[model samples]
Target: MSTPDQPAAFKPPANDPWKGFRGVCSGTLILESIVVFLAIPAIAKLGEGVGAGAVVYLVVLGVVMILACGVQSRPWAMGLNLGLQVALIAGWFVHPAVGAMGLLFAAVWVYMLYLRKDIQARIERGLLPGQRD
Candidate 1:
């Protein structure tokens, strides 16, 4: 309630929630890249000796994941991330451990997407803290 001469207090607009989400996605990619790199030693020793081509493939995929981190804000970034997951799973040809790692990360991505949808629904309902009157 305000008097005729008194103005209502000012409230700043809500922050862009997706900004933090992008950071999380970037960090996850970096972690995934490290894991992919670490799998190299296992690939060489545990399996029937990894081929030079297979090693090169893993290295390139890891590097691509790191590079993808820089573009997390783009609209197509999610598509690229999902594509990489598929590539990792396809690593079945190279080694089963690599494929298992991909499956684990894919589950993580599914959960992240579910959280994204929940946030969007909250925003639409004006249920976020900043949206309150």
Candidate 2:
């Protein structure tokens, strides 16, 4: 279908995209956990003052995020990840900064989901180079 003046679209070698996807998800969770941990100082200094409850909540949530990374390959993992996002957004009650961070990361996750869908579509359509030959 390509004209002499026009090159065909590039198709990467077919491979297990989900492997890299899991890695990306894990990395994102780790980074989000770091950001959540970093928000502790802000919460302590700026908000109603870091009470024991706030500290515990943030620390626990960060730990949960880290732990969630380990289960990224599970069927329930996406639901769990989405649930964590809701929990993070709920942190607004603790501090607006925490909620804002949640919103930011939520956007990132949404984009990731969109890309996942696209990849799945490509696989189904045999668009990958490995699929071609």
Candidate 3:
């Protein structure tokens, strides 16, 4: 519907940006937080010296994720999210298993971001359902 200079008659998402990406990431974070909460006791048993700190860290991370998801329109939110995912990898200090899980989620984050890009490109090309090519 559009060339290089203008919008098509089939206008697309104009008001919200990155909505799909934000939603996916936010949902993932919610589940991650739940996992962290459930794993607290196990982590506490494994990292005797760092258990309390780990608990606090996990709680704070969840809070930050909530805030980031709430304000995903801000560019910094995604950066903060990625930064936290990297930080989660540091859970290896507490337990190798948790660290391994963190790495898995980190990969998920990466895949989702790439998926988002592909989705956006499809929308732009009118390749999505209900879109005109």
Q: Give all candidate RMSDs, comma-separated.
A: 5.0, 4.9, 3.9
**Model 2 poorest 10 in a row by lDDT:** 7-16
Least accurate stretch of 10 residues (summed lDDT) in model 1? 7-16
lDDT for model 2 comes to 0.87
**C-alpha TM-score for every candidate:** 0.87, 0.86, 0.76
- Tell how far residue 14 is off in model 1, in angstroms: 1.3
Angstrom error at residue 116, model 1: 1.2
lDDT of each: 0.88, 0.87, 0.73
TM-score of 2: 0.86
lDDT of 2 by residue, 1-133 (tens): 6589976555565687788888999999999999999999977888467778878989999999999999999988878988999999999888888889999989998998897898888877668667685
RMSD score of candidate 2 (Å): 4.9
Model 3, span 64-105: residue lDDT tens: 766666776677776777887887788777677678878988
Regions of model 2 farther than 4 Å from truth? 1-14
